[model samples]
Target: MAEDIEPLPVPRRIDFDFPDDIDPNWKADDPEFCAMVNGASLTMPYLEPFLIKTVRETARHIDDPRVQEEAKAFNTQEQFHYRAHRRFNELIKAKGYPELAGLEARMEAAYARLSTRSLRTRMAYTAGFEAMTMGVTRWLINNRVQLFGGSDTRVASFILWHFVEEAEHKCVAFDVYQAAYGGSLGGYFARARGVFHGALDVMFNSMRGYKIILRKAGLWGQLRSRLRLARRLGSFAWTVAPYLLRAALPGHTPRREREPQWVHDWIAQYPHAPEGYIPLLDTHSPTMPVPFPSARAATGAAA
Candidate 1:
């Protein structure tokens, strides 16, 4: 049935209005959790461009048309994601984290180092990162209410929108990897290596960013906050452990994985948010949020 569905990688130009008065932890009430998620967001502007370049280059060597098309679509979607996050990062910087720029520069340099590696190595890293994001996407969707409830609407919508797209183009990199390198034992080893490498990159970068944000906010050395952060990390690992293990299997692919119902329902009702904004999720209930088309949609309807 998935084969019967058409590939549509729509480029959305939505923006968020993060008020200057908002706190650093714009999403959840937990300061530690907020810092952790912010840390991850900080990596996108650098990490995503690296992904786009890697996928685009590898797509060139592949003879398959479908894979090529998917690669372009994947790059387009990531383009939207990174740009949106870049703007949000600016908002975070406005909140007085002057040290944030230094952290981002370090991450940029790290990716620059990675760019020198072989094509196969880069593609392996892309596949591995996508695989991990797929797991994180599912986890976030399943626990949407618990994690985002009562959070700032703009920030919540921004994060959910990005992850939803991540889920949408879930299989592109894996397909590219398989097309270029067969599912041989060597391929499996490359994918596994990527998983570890990408995971460490995210964790290390996120932890560093978190410490910077908390230190600037004057919460870094607070024992209570530190303990809460440790517990949250442990719980997150437990939730996504199954996905990490499954991704390591030779035959495992996102094609066999089921898409989350919330993501399904969300996309179905997409373009629903007003112009210049991301679609809002109902933080209080799992029920589908009401769909209201943007001014662009209304203009089309009038036409």
Candidate 2:
């Protein structure tokens, strides 16, 4: 069935509107908040190279021109995201969050390990990761007020813009995988394993960053503070755990139906969001300008 399916030669590009109500300089006054923001901001740049590498490597296995086009668009959007986040991270550093350097180093090492896998495995993992990101992005957009807590229009707009694009390309990696690898048992197992490991890395790394923030805020010793932290962690776990569990299902399908109505409303309101401003590629080409390193290189690097 996968063999019969063709990848889309051209993927849709979406334009995002920046929210105007939030102040860009709001993070300047809040040290703790700025630290958290910095942690998130630092993640995108580290992620971009991994995404580009994955797309280029997997492109070779794609028989459909459309799929190839989608891969290129995915890389482009990710690059834009990386640049945007880099700027934001710099702002955080300027505000005195230089401790982000160590976190970035740890994240790079983790990704370096991932880069060693076979192309198929890497792509499979990417699809799973992308699916999870789509869910989180959608959830964040739907609950932007709750997440951001303040009326800083700039911060809100920047984050939402990124989420919109994430939602738009959510299906690209999975589609590519199914098209190229036939969604076999081995493929599913590999994907599931990758998702589990990746989730652990994300959770641990995030906790470490959060602890650094707590330490900087001088709240590390208070029991009440610890309880509040636990509650927040519990809440996030409750929110994301179900989705992660469902991902392990043999026929799991991520549907808009399971998400909150606000998410659906946003999706409906912005039906053309994916194609709003970003230009789509006109044609698909088998030959990628950027040649991915051989599987040997990936594995050898890991070794």
Candidate 3:
């Protein structure tokens, strides 16, 4: 697949402003879902950079030029994602969750430990995280309306754009991992170990985030919110677990992953924005290309 397909990693720097007026609970009044997303947002700043570091280090071990270029492009995308999410996270923090800072500190410590691992182990971790993210983007795109309906469009657009790019570079890490260790039994076992560790770490971090927010909001022990959170988690697992399992299989490649139609269509459309900007995405119909906003509008207004 590496020789068969060309990677188009166009670096579109989308600036999504989450002004004070925007709802802290932005998912259509769903506090559980809001906390869940906010919790995940905390990881982006540290996690993306960790992933970039892992890929960059692994690229030195890979000989394929295309894979190396894709890794560099993938690093660029992750850079944009973390920077944007860091801004969004400030808004989340301003919403009065003091525990967020503590949670973020713990996240930093965890990644610092990961930074000490071997190159192979680190690259395996990157592959695991990327594969999981690919499945998540698919589920989010397919259920966008249910998840983001009646929410802030600017925030929704921001998240969707990130997910779209996640979809765009879906195969880069897997290909890199394969380039280093494709058919060997050790490779299969390493990939499985990485996926398991990655998945567990994500769940733990997200739960830590959720606890910080939910307890701060006085909703952690509340039965109603607990039920809602459980239901949401169930839905997520139901949609994503199979994909993770598939990735663990021998000879599996992200190229064979089944992306949602709109996601595939999005790459096909290939819409471009001015340098340092991207189009204001229409979340309802992701396939539709809206006109780019004026400079002022992109940075201000309705955010």
Candidate 4:
């Protein structure tokens, strides 16, 4: 039953170390994938604050106490996440891609403009964006081994932790939308439109950041880089397509997308993890066991 239940979006104050010379390719061997993921990371500082503002404002329209509480918790979790990503994103910029500043500015301006839109429109965008997260979170966790293997521990753990919270609070935004709009047909269409608009908008900006960063890295025009990105994007689409499709349909709630085992383990284990640095995922270990308190203790001892 514990496994069946998701914890609230509890705020974790774990620390991550990102030194001056840290490799932006925390993936170690996968720079192309790094570009894509880091590009997504670059959007977080701007995008998430936009989300927090929109969700918070809409919370006033809903009478459900649980929904309101969830909204607050979700915003708290996002505050921590964006701050962590903002810290790491600084490393990405310092590593070389000054042009990323331009991308960030553009996103900041765009989100500011989006902020002026009606509450329903903003809420719909959030619901749609969050709806896509069910698939995105699954994709990240499903490929954790392949993606984070031998990667920098601090980064790998930080990213996984963020997504774990994402999985935990999976229903908050969608529920907020439902609470605000009730079950109206027009609301359904708005949500459907948001699925496309929100997902495409984020991805478009992310890839633009990717191009700028990769061009600076001298990988943007390389034949191998292009091919790899294409294949990975194709695979990501194939993996997440059904989840996105379902989210756009009527009567679809996030609960229909089951949380993966890792999501459960992460929530179960985090409470016991010693209160300091979040334990790094043991990249060298074949099993990549959940970072339980005892495991964290052992890893700290061995280090």
Which candidate achieves the best lDDT against the true structure? Answer: 4
All candidates: CA RMSD (Å): 4.5, 13.3, 4.7, 3.3
Q: Report the poorest 10 consecutive residues by lDDT, candidate 2.
A: 282-291
Tens-place lDDT digits, model 3, residues 78-151: 99999999988888888787668888998999899999987778888888888898778877787787787666
Task: For candidate 2, write residues 131-185 as lDDT tens digits.
Answer: 6675576456454545554435455556665665666666577666767774688
Residue 30 C-alpha lDDT in model 2 = 40
Choose the strongest candidate by TM-score. Answer: 4
Where in model 3 is the C-alpha error above 4 Å?
Answer: 1-3, 270-278, 281-303
Ranking by TM-score: 4, 3, 1, 2
Candidate 4: tens digits of C-alpha lDDT, residues 80-119? 9999999999888888778799889999999999989888
Clashes in model 3: which pairs? none
| Stretches of candidate 2 exceeding 4 Å from the true structure | 1-37, 255-303
Clashes of each: 0, 13, 0, 0
RMSD of 3: 4.7
Taking all chains together, each candidate's TM-score versus the true structure is: 0.89, 0.73, 0.89, 0.93
